[model samples]
Target: MRQNLNYSYPQIFWVEGRPNLGTSCPSAPPIAPFPPPVPDRRRKPKNHTERRSVGLLVTSLLILLALTGVGLSMFRIFHLEKELAELRESASTERIPPALEKLIGQKEQSMKKEARKAAHLTGNPSQRDLPLEWEPTSGHAFTSGIQYCDHGLVINETGFYFVYSNVLFRGSVCSNQVLTHVVYKKNPTLPGSHVLMEDKGINYCMSQKTWARKSYLGALFKLRKMDSLHVNVSKIALVNFEESKTFFGLFKL
Candidate 1:
C-alpha cells in the first residue's frame, strides 16, 4: 500500500486511510462574473410610444386652442363689423327732410299741448254743514274724463273710479264737537245723494289747547256716466281750507 495516493477526481470516502474514488460529487457550474454592475445611465419609457404620445397630445391641444381662439376672434370681428354697419345705416337714415321735420315738430308740439291732465280736485267754497264746492283751475285742479261742475265731479264715462278726499279740521279753541265728513254720490237717476264714505271725530283733541286733526277717505266705486260726487262736512267753519290739507279727487279706473 502506498503511504499517500493522488487522484484527479476528489475522493468520496476513505477506509483505513485508503482512497475510494468510485463515487464523487459533481462540481458546480462556474457563474460568469457580472461586469461590475453598471449603473443605468440611459432612461427608457415603459411603453415605447408613451413619451412621444404625451408630447404629441400636448402639441395637438395647443394647436386646437389656437384654432379655437382664432375662430372666436374672427367671429367677434365679423359680429362687430355687422353691428357697425347697422349703426352706420341707422345714423345715415336718422336725418329727416326739412318739411317732414317741421311736421314732426308741429305734431310733437300739438301732442304736448294736448297732453292728458289728471283729475286732482283742490279748491274752494263751503258753508257750515253744507256741501263743499271746488275751484277747477287752482291748486292742482285738473280734469280729464271727470268734470268739475257746480261742486261735484261729473263722470264722463261709465267705469270704476277711485275717489279720495282729505279734510283738515282745526279751531282756535278746542270745542269737543262731533266733526263729520261725508262724501256722497248723486245723479239724476237717484232721488237723494248716496253716502259713499263718512267719518266722525269725537273727543279728538285736548280740551283747552288749539288742535288740528285730519280726516282722509279714499275708496273705489263703480260709477256710471254722468254720476256726480260731492264732499260735505258737518262743521265747515272749523275746516282748514289749505289746498295741501283739503282736497278731493276722482280718477277713472
Candidate 2:
C-alpha cells in the first residue's frame, strides 16, 4: 500500500535536523601508537661549558681577593712612608745638642790659644836663642831619665808642654815598653829611686844606674828655646847603652 509514506523517519546521514559526524570513524586509523609518547627524554647539559663557567667564577674570585690584599698592603706602605718622611723632616729642623755646641766653643778657644802662641814665637827674632823647656806641672815629678815623645801633652807645675820622645825599652824600642807612671825605688847609695811620667822615660838622681838610650835627643834642642836653661846649646848627649859609649848630636834648636 503506497499508502501514506508521509511518516517522518531519520535519514541515513542525518539525525533529526543535524548531520551525523561519525560515531566510530573507522577507529581513528589506530593512532600510530602515539609515537610512544615521544620518549619524554630530556636534553643533556653541556658538561664542558658548565665546568668552564664554574672554573671562571673561581679564578675571578681568587684574582679579586689577591688584588684586594695587594691594594691594602700598598696603602699601608704608603702611609708608613709618609709618616717616616715627616719624622725625618722634623728631626732635620730640630736643634742640635748643647754638648755639641759646647765642643765647638772649646775648639774655637783652642784655636785662639794656639794663634797667640804662634804669633809670639814667629815674631820673636831671638826665639831661636831662647831656651825652650817643657812646662812642668806643680804636682807632677819627672821620673828618671829625660825622654822625648812625639805624642801626648803634659801639664804640670810649670805649664803645658808636649813630651819630647817616647821611652826606649831595653834591647829594643817598643811602644808598649814606654814608661808611663813614675815611682821611687829604695837604694843604699841613692836613698830611693823615683819613677815619674807613666809613659815617658823616668829621671832619677842616681848616677850609678845606667841611662837608657834617648830616641828623641833631637827633640831636646827644640825644647831648649822653651826655657832659659840651654837656649844656646844645640848639642844633646846621647848614650849608646849597647856599646856603653857616650856621644852627642846637633840639637834641633
Candidate 3:
C-alpha cells in the first residue's frame, strides 16, 4: 500500500536529548563557561582587600588628628611666649627701696660739699713783705674759696675746719736757722690776725754740707664766715716751694 510520504516529524540532531550549543550552532560564537560568574572588583572586594581598605581609612584619620594636634601645640607655644615676655617686663619695672635712694642723694650732697668748701694750696713765694701767697693752680692744688685780697684762702661758710701746713727749709750751708711755720686767721671783725697753728724747727739738720728742715702745723679749729687764713714763715728765702715740700690746705668738718 502506498502511504502518504508528506507526513512531518520532529527534527533530531542530538541523541543525548541535551543540546550542545557549541556544536549545534556552529554559526554562533563558542559559548563560554559563563566566565565562572566573574565578580566586579570595584563593587565587591575580597577578605584581605576589605581589611586593607579599613586599615588605610584608619591611617588617614590618624594623620589628620596628628596635624590638628601640632597646630594646637604651636598656638599654645605662642601664647606662652607672649605671657613670659609680659612677666619679664613687669619684673624690670619693680620698685626700689626709698631709703636707698635717700642714701644715694646724701652721698652726692656730701661729695658736692667737699668740693665746694675745701681749699688745697701749694706754697708760692711773693715779693711783697706780707704772708706768703699760695699757688692754687699747681699740681694737685686747688682752691674752692677765693683769695682774700690776694692774701690767703677766704672762708665762705662757718664750720669746724681742719687746717694744715707744711714748710720745708732747705739750704746748701748748715747754719741751723730756726724754721718757723705759722698758720694765722684774720677776721674783719678782729683787729689783728690770730694764730691758729704754729710749729718750730730747732737744731734740725745741724751737721751736713746740705741741710734741710721741715716744720708742719695742723689743727682743727672752729672758724667763722669771711675769715681769711694765712701762712707765715720766719724766713721766706729759706722755704722751698715744692708741692710735696710745702703745702697748705683746709677742709670743713
TM-score of each: 0.54, 0.28, 0.57
Over the stretch 99-142, how does candidate 3's per-residue lDDT look in tens digits? 97799889989888777778788877654465887788768888
Per TM-score, the best of the predicted structures is 3
Question: How many clashing residue pairs appear in each of the predictions shown?
Answer: 0, 44, 0
lDDT for each residue of candidate 2 in 20-51, tens digit (9 for 90 to 100)? 66454543353444444554358765599889
Q: Show the colliding residue pairs in model 3.
A: none
Cα-based lDDT for every prediction? 0.81, 0.36, 0.81
Which regions in candidate 1 have their CA more than 4 angstroms from the true location?
Answer: 1-118, 125-129
| Residue 63's lDDT in candidate 3 | 99
- Model 2, C-alpha of 89: deviation from truth (Å): 2.2
Question: Residue 244 error for model 2, in Å?
Answer: 24
Give me the overall lDDT of model 2: 0.36
The 10-residue segment of model 3 with minimum total lDDT is: 19-28
